[model samples]
Target: MVIPDLGRSPRPAPPHVGPRPEPGSFRDPANRVFHAGDDVLRALDRTAAADWRALAASSFFPPLLTAGKVCGTEELPAGSPLRELPTAPASSGWATVLRHERVPFVSHPYEWSFAMLRDAALLHLEILRAALPAGFTTKDGSAYNLQWRGTEPVFIDIGSFTPLRDGEPWAGYRQFCQTLLYPLMLGAHLGLAFQPWLRAQVDGIEPEQMGPLFRGTRRLLPGVLTHVHLHGSVQRRSAATSTADVRAQLRDAGYTRELAVATVRGLEKLVRRLDHQPAATHWVDYQHTCGYSGDDRASKERFVLAALSAAGRRRLVLDLGANDGRYARLAARHADYVVAVEQDPAVVDRLYRSLRGEGERHVLPLVMDLADPSPGGGWRGIERASFAARADADTVLALALVHHLAIGRNVPLPEVVACLAGLTAPGGRLVVEFVHPDDPMAARLLANKPDGIFPDYRRDAFETLLAEHGTVEDRLELPSGTRTLYRVALP
Candidate 1:
């Protein structure tokens, strides 16, 4: 397959964007989040406001920020620091606003690799363990509460932190299993890709979902009996019980604070021990099948380095179709951070694991099909920003990518150029490679198409289309003139 790492717009600030109540905010009465340009502002009502004020003054919150376990938070009084916020609800019930350190990139669980999900689970467990000692526990433990800052998984929901009551069962335990544990197991143990299910079932793969996947002998795997099979059975039995009655029964059955700790510990151990031997995929070994000779590959690498140097002091970089992230890692050296998007789940997991420790300090790989970018969803369309709206980069590396997009996805070349150009900040650079008609990969991509459909997809036409969207700074040819790389700046 010809590889183009598949990888949007701006309008008015909200109130124009509607009530702009972020999706899922209605579930919690404490606060609501609003996206105002680059800042993530959370408007807190009286209950959440009081909680924030107390948490801000305490010693507990400081350590997590210092340790990078949580996002940096600043209290913004309505009229003081935040002179104006367009998305705030008009009601005077709100007490204050919080300006959270924007996570460099916001990704969904469906977009994550197995390693990313595993790390997120551990992060959640760590927060629970840490908070319990501080006289609090996260009341809501959805995987969405976390976002990636390079390779680091940092907790983003300031509202999830609520006081813990003694002898209360972990409210998020079932959610943790459904979202984190079951999905991790599905991938690590069953060799299945959990992303599709995650995308379809945003609430996550439930015990019942796993129950069908595991039958008879396969049900004997570690934690499968208690967390999936039997748990699903118990959940089915408890369907008729009221929440208050269940609580009372749990209290009577000795489900205390100690059990809560034990539960978190058990989940943590299972999460840490979970491992996946990733199966080989067509594109995971990108360099081998990417149709590049050693010297030609090195030529593209040098071209990318030159582009980054020209772009200079890039705060953000993007690697589209970053199969195993060879170029994303190279871009990471030049930018403060990088988001690498790939379509193959196995490929994403490979790169995600490679980014551990020092490698993780700069690169975050996500599973996103280039043809279909993530869209805004939830309460209003604005709750989640489309990938196009949020993934702006100072420099973008679209190496070996456009041919597949134009040929594989049937997107017009000019439209493809414009789509990529829009992702770049004005004055930002795109180092995009064009695989010519004669290149083997390009021919393979074109084989399925009817003739004359993409007649304008040639190098000269590519330069013209690029000129329509941005200024072509330089063009570097590799593959002995069959494939060429264009460095362009958006108009």
Candidate 2:
């Protein structure tokens, strides 16, 4: 009933069925994104509205739009660009759509693996390249705007691509550094995982902040020099200047569409072959050096597969601290969507490479340290969502993760259970591993720290705490006498 009348006689009114923002609500003020009659309309402010209409009319946006590779959009109100721009929907708003085949899961930077982040950077650069000839530039370059449409990256917010004037430095330069450049540099040169840092600084790492973190070589890299060191230094040095001059200077930098596209391509090349040197840590052995016997490995695998089956069909599975996605693959079978999160850059790199080769779009790998998750704290705290805000997951696989939290990190089992419960969707499942004190992994983890403080950390205590949130789904002893697996479901 919501079909367009382009091919037929125009109707007097368009039926408005979808939810619309309440009048007077100032949500998304930057671009007036609201609902008008069953359609999502982005209201252009009067000042830039006419230019935007011209840019939209050009050959640039329509190719991707008609291909359905991008979101549906159309111009309206003839000659009045500020009025409204509407888009057709296969369904309704993003909040309530279930099993929505077109748009799948929403992912955040903290959840990206090295490759995913790198690819996203490449995609952004590619967009910049394509937009240059048409005199358009990406005003909003937040990583959130890039979403995976299958294996390839697609820009979601159509409003961000606006007509570029003669000489405006890419408006999103700082954001590009924070989200893409700094993180990529850390991962590539310093061998540091960007997830932990990204988690804390929601907006992104300031050049001033990132400058101090870099060792000598990080400061020397050419890409680092032009993009991070020099760029950030200039911004800080010029902080005293009035806002109008800075904007004008940036806009008058003689940065053409070609230069913008070239800059993006340059970034892509730099990120593709970045090499990160690994650091020494106890848990770093989770993949290669862990002294797990054959039996211990067998037990963990069996338990993991069982838990996966328990998740059943059409699951959005979350593998917390998913080192190299070894256990993530177990749940992949039952899941239509899988998000594998880990703290180590090395492990995340390996996992991403493997998944990328397989062309598996459903599994989204992220680099994250569970203890310090990404918090929402930028421009009014609404720029990015916190770890909990992003969690509407149907199931969580926290294998071999509790030991780090309880024994090594000093987190209580009850609080851990509480955190896990908070992430699961209504009636969602949680499959976690309990490592006994005698377990080799647990013993090694505790070896570095003074440990009798966690005397209450036992299987029974974990079970009791987990019971407070959900019923126990299954439990199996791992090959190691000290390790076992437990799956729980919310009552």
Q: Estimate each model's TM-score.
A: 0.88, 0.76
What does candidate 2's lDDT look like per residue over 1-491, in tens digits? Answer: 01122121111234655444423223334444554443445555543355556655777766755544445556553554324333223322222110111334556776676677777877777777777788788776777667764345556666577777765667777788888878888877766778767767666788887778654865777477787778887888887987567657766776566776777777778777775645545445566666668887887787777767755663567889887677777677777777788877666767777787887766777666778776665656755557777676778888878888887788888888899888887788888888888877788777887758778888898888988898997888765567778889886
Identify the runs in model 1 with alpha carbons over 4 angstroms from their true place. Answer: 1-24, 53-60, 77-79, 83-92, 379-382, 447-453
> Considering summed lDDT, which 10 consecutive residues are worst modelled in model 1?
1-10
Pick the TM-score winner: 1
Query: Tens digits of per-residue lDDT for model 1 on 319-349?
Result: 9988878889888778877899998888988
Model 2 stretches astray by more than 4 angstroms: 1-57, 62-103, 110-114, 149-152, 186-193, 207-220, 228-292, 380-382, 447-451
Best by lDDT: 1
Question: What lDDT would each prediction earn against the true structure?
Answer: 0.79, 0.68
Error of 2 at 446 (Å): 4.0
